[model samples]
Target: MTPAAVNDADIHNKLRKELAQSRVLLVDRHPEARNFLRMTLSAVGITSVRNAGTAHEALRQARNARFDVILADYLLDHGRDGQQLFEELRQQQLIPLASVFMIVTGERAYRRVVSVAELAPDDYLIKPFTADQLQSRLLRAMYKKKHFAEIYGHLEDDAFVDALAALESLLARSSEFALDGLRLKGEILNALGRYDEASEVYREVLAARVAPWARMGLALALRGRGELAEALVEAQALTEDFPEYLAAYDLTADLHERTGDLTAAQETLLAASGRSPDNATRQRQVGHLAVRNKDLAVAEKAFGKALDRLRGSSLRQLDDYTNLARVRIDKGDIAGARSVAADLRREFRGGKGSEAAESADVAELAALVVDSLAAGRTGDAEAAKNALNAALARHDSLANRRSTAVSQHLAVDLAHACLAQGEEARAQALLRRAAAEHHDDEGMIDRIRGVFARAGKEHLGEAMLTQVSDEIVDLNNKGVLAARSGDLDAAISMLSQAAERVANVQFLVNAAKAIFTKMNRDGWDEALAERAQGYVRRAQAKDAASPRVVSARELCQRVAKKYGVQLESAAKWKKGTDSEAE
Candidate 1:
């Protein structure tokens, strides 16, 4: 807006052409500064500028209009900075996530703010820059925004697969833009459960700086491999450096639990919940852990807070409610659990409308089981089963698709109910199938084994453990030889086949090890081994340890020990280069 700059008429004409169909917001405290930006934008054939002279005016304009681009000053002459105002607009839903934010700043404070803020602005530029510099930065931001528009939209809509597809498309656009798109695409891939693809991207990014996100992502991938120690280290170190990176703390808790450090896991989660108090998911997780520890007061408080904050979020899971009910059941409040069960049924059946929400019937059934088990009522269990069947029958092909979560839950509850009625054989059959169905899900499988152990069926629990262990070992050995021969695809194929027959800790550990050896990645290996150990321990927690079980257990330990993963924290646990220890 200097006297030497291009005239307003030429700039205005440029803006008219550029922003004919777009909505733009311009906030500047000084009229000369405002006119300069306006003229600069106009010279570029952009129009549709809604001007605000102050932070108050910007907030007022945001309240009344929907803007596609926000061009604001970093140091506004108001109580709040642009960062605060930007977050306020976002909270009000007046600015969509896709809208580009450009900060015109001469202040040094904005850079420090940018370092910690999660939702980053699209671009920032110092004041008194040339028209060329502004044009370059804006064009760069615009291209990125335009290219990722579809993908961002899908993510906003919570259509994970669709967003994943958009990321993939963006990746394949051309090498010219792939570098910028790769990181985001990897994040989207992780969101979609494509860990292997995400791992590849993280590995590539790690060659530069040990990005905390990439480091944490690798740890998660390794945790999936049963590499608990390695994953734990990555998470812990990352958390130490970036305490504000709450995901690392959350991940560390999971690694702790995988290693049977329940107290450590609980502490980690509590700390994380404290750090990110506004995160509903983190609050729900704390509530869940509290319920597991039988701390009803803590569970109720956490769940209540989550329920209030995440009211409008459709993705807020029913786990918080279920855990609260569990706490009530443990406190000898059967009626409370029953009421919670009813509430679950209503929430899943009525309030839930997304595809994931459609999985509400499953929650309803679990709630019903919780209530029945607390009351020790076999008749109510049968009624609940019939109701679940009726509810599931309404969804077209829903049952077939959810053979994992829903099917096993049904079978386990039915077995628990049968046991209460003294139908030993019926209970055994139901439980056996349920174990097979949930062999891959370590959490659910442990819960099933815990039920048997608590019921005083020591021998049956050992037998089930033997069967599951054998299936996993058989699958693991099939990959073991191929892994030695450097036939990773063959190894992967064999292990995947084994996973189908049985879900076992040792098997997953081997699979994870194979992935590590072939991929050259970073994560916590000891954690993975601990998770496998947990499965075996749950089978014998309440009785005399088995001799044969110990023997097989040693063999599985040796397999992992050969790959830099010690079964326990023993000093003399190093494996030689033979890589062929039976």
Candidate 2:
């Protein structure tokens, strides 16, 4: 044999040895298929294997254990496929970046599967493939994972600076994976808000070849730098050329929204949702945009589909039911709205206890408000009045727990119902609470305005929203001014009080940032650090992906590292449900 052949043999043998030590998970609907694959793996000296018959089971196993390789068949039950499952796993961070995920499919479905997936798997295998082909692909993917391991480690720790350095080192070597390294570098730069560098990196890639991801990255970079017109042109061109690129559509929709063109945004989301009907996140976005555009029919369809797709998944939220009901009520479908309320009650009937019970109570109260709205529309005055009164009586008890969009929407709906009953004081109070809690959210503010307009109280909404905005600004400025003047103690106290008063993401993040700054400057105070951690948790619960929240977290992490303190795991700070990219 030639020298190159000999070297190839040596590398193959080493990879085989490593594969024998790897853990694998097999996912297929057919028992025989899994059995055959397991036996094939065992024949190759790979004995550590687990099997899951469905996507849900695979997710459960993935959550409990780390697997080096996951091989899933393309077709699964419940109207889902391997591609969708892979998307879910990545979105939820259930699988580490270093793991290999290969999708197995029939030859006929390969093209469709490859073209439509928003995120690609590591590799693909056609049915009736030999053990040798699987092994070769697995070895290649594992090698790439090893090559990027350092960068992945930095990313997992949220160390963007270190990750970029690692990427630069890898790129400087001009290795076979240099293109992939550039892709990752662009992502990290964009995440760090370094739009100019990101745009340059993506442009370099585009100059080399017509890569879809590179184009998408360029559009995102442009958008980040406020070059919306150029970004829209690039994104629209990508969608026109490669209609299967769903991320472009999302970016395009966001650009339209930024330009205050809700109609165009709704149209863009509608097109994307139609292409990927099983994507609950996109469906929810469609619903939200449709509602804003007053396209009730589209809103109803989008929310209904989201509820259906997320029915049995852990990702389902109470917002799904309430959003659909609200759309139905707006469409004048009183009976349809009532049916959704009934489903909500049935879904949350028997709680799991403790916090679960409290969640159930919140859902129940939300459903009551929906039903009362339906009753009012149907002229059942007595039923409407009673339900509305009961919801109002319980409102104060749950006020402090209103941290999510669901609760905010509930407050708005309750206020709308109160206005219908001519209770101006009660309606104004609910509106104030919702506005104060979500002061930084332009979408929620717009929603509150929509409710006011629908009730013929647009003038009242302007004055009330102004008051709430001013109050929040005053609260934030006082603490900021105190901190700027080097009064750390007073700053911490004032910010903490602001957080206590509103519990909004802005206030909570500010409070945590102030505490961490003080801790970083002075000696570490365990009590103060604990309070800061609490504020961070609260802010995360409200909006974990908020830039402000992320900044506060990074500050806390730096302080903890300086003090040699071992903080809690990042996973604990994540919300219970899966979150999608914006």
Candidate 3:
């Protein structure tokens, strides 16, 4: 006896009427599964359905078409899985907010991963479901997305006030969407820096039901409102109740750090790591915290774990290798540092060539210099120094004239290498340059000061760095005065010239803003647009993790749009579920 096919004529007619023009994509490794999905879709009057057997093929199909509905299996062929594919698509901005992404999985364990994800699918369905069940989920998802379009547009435009108003209207108009509207309203309020209002909205949600996300939002809102004790209690309770909630762990650790409980913060992260050991981002955060605490053992262990997780993935970065090597050198384990440096060299050697190739080569040579100095291999250190100089010189010639992609961390590495080679004057000059470029950044200044102390020249480095810092600060102050005087062009010129002299991210961001202001007043100029983007790109490369840099990046996108310049990755942040809205 064969299994009977699902035949629900009334359900098909209803779904078809509701989703008349919908385009669907089915991703499954099994041909039988694809055939079954296609038959189900066809029965529901959805004839435009594409099929892909692998994640890569599915990605290709998605890129080629704007799919209204994407039904992906939890497990795909080969190493790739549906979750990874979904993340890649979102990262690349290949998927739109209005589209529905469904996780169709037979495995019950898939729910665990979905529950804690920062971004999850719009809907999920367990396998072994009837066609009627599939139609019901799809219709609900489509209805929500369609109804939320007006609020989404305002939110995308950064019009939080307008978005809130629209959400209020939606709630008043349809009780069916009250929870979604309230959730979105809370997120918009949070983004607008209205923590008090956001907290109220979140409390309203909690009154309706105990949602993990709402609880997280309430904690974040409390923190934003400067109610640390309250936020701490909520986050603590959340972690105890839902240990799988990664955000709760992160929030708990951050609050502990803010309150000066470093030990507690470390323990919280360690506990979370025990639960989800494969999360590279959490491992990196743990390593950074441990390093700040001067706990080399914990830092080393966390970084090693991160390296293992990042291995063979595109997410692997030079910082992971450099950070681990730095820790080893601090621990006086020259052999360990040498091994890490060798691994770094191998990691970049086979990579596809990019403009940053020269920078990477120079960084590798600088790392070798550290390892050589630690081992007392004077000749090897000298060779590495020469190679590093050659690499820098090549980088100078190859770099774009309009771009100042200065990496302060790389400069610190070179300064350390120069000090190792007994070139105190050159080392001092390099460190002074970095300090001058990042004068307003107390954290970067402290890091530079620490490096100087490691070289036994703390007093001398401090005096030189202070002098340069004062000079740069004065120059920036003059630029600000010019901007305040309504001379946008003059402000841009002053700040941009200072940026060229110092390769400062602050100067570049200011100049970019001034240029944008000028363009908005005096009409768009292609030259200014290009120059602005160059500054944004340079700032991004120098300090990608900084919130200031991220804000600058967002402003650059707005400026690009104003000037009709096409930009990539212009989306503000990750967008998928309610969590991303916050």
* Best model number under lDDT: 2
Which candidate do you rate higher for TM-score, 2 or 3? Answer: 2
Q: lDDT by residue for model 3 over 110-180, one digit each (tens)?
A: 66665544335776688888877888899888767878998776545434456678888888878977776
Task: Report the C-alpha lDDT of model 1 over 369-445, residue by residue, as the tens digit.
Answer: 56556656334656655544443343224547644244454556546645554556766766665666455555566
Whole-model alpha-carbon lDDT for candidate 2: 0.82
TM-score of each: 0.51, 0.89, 0.75
RMSD of 1: 15.6
Query: Which numbered prediction scores highest in TM-score against the true structure?
Result: 2
Q: Ten-residue segment with the worst summed lDDT in candidate 1?
A: 573-582
Tens digits of per-residue lDDT for model 2 on 1-582?
999899879977887899999999999999999999998888778999999998878877777788899999988865567876786777566778888899999988788656544246888888898888888889998888888999887666555566789889888886778878888898878776788999999999889977888888899889888899999999998888877677788889989988888899889988877767777788898999889888899899999998998675665678889899999988899889999999988887776867667767888888889978888888898899988998886676676665423467788899988988787899998889889998867678999998889889999999999999999999999999999898999999999999988889989989998998998899799999999999988787676545566667767877887889877634434424344421
- Pick the winner on TM-score between candidates 1 and 2: 2
By TM-score, the better pick of 1 and 3 is: 3
Ranking by lDDT: 2, 3, 1
Name the lDDT value of residue 454 in candidate 1.
54
RMSD of each: 15.6, 3.3, 6.9
TM-score of 2: 0.89
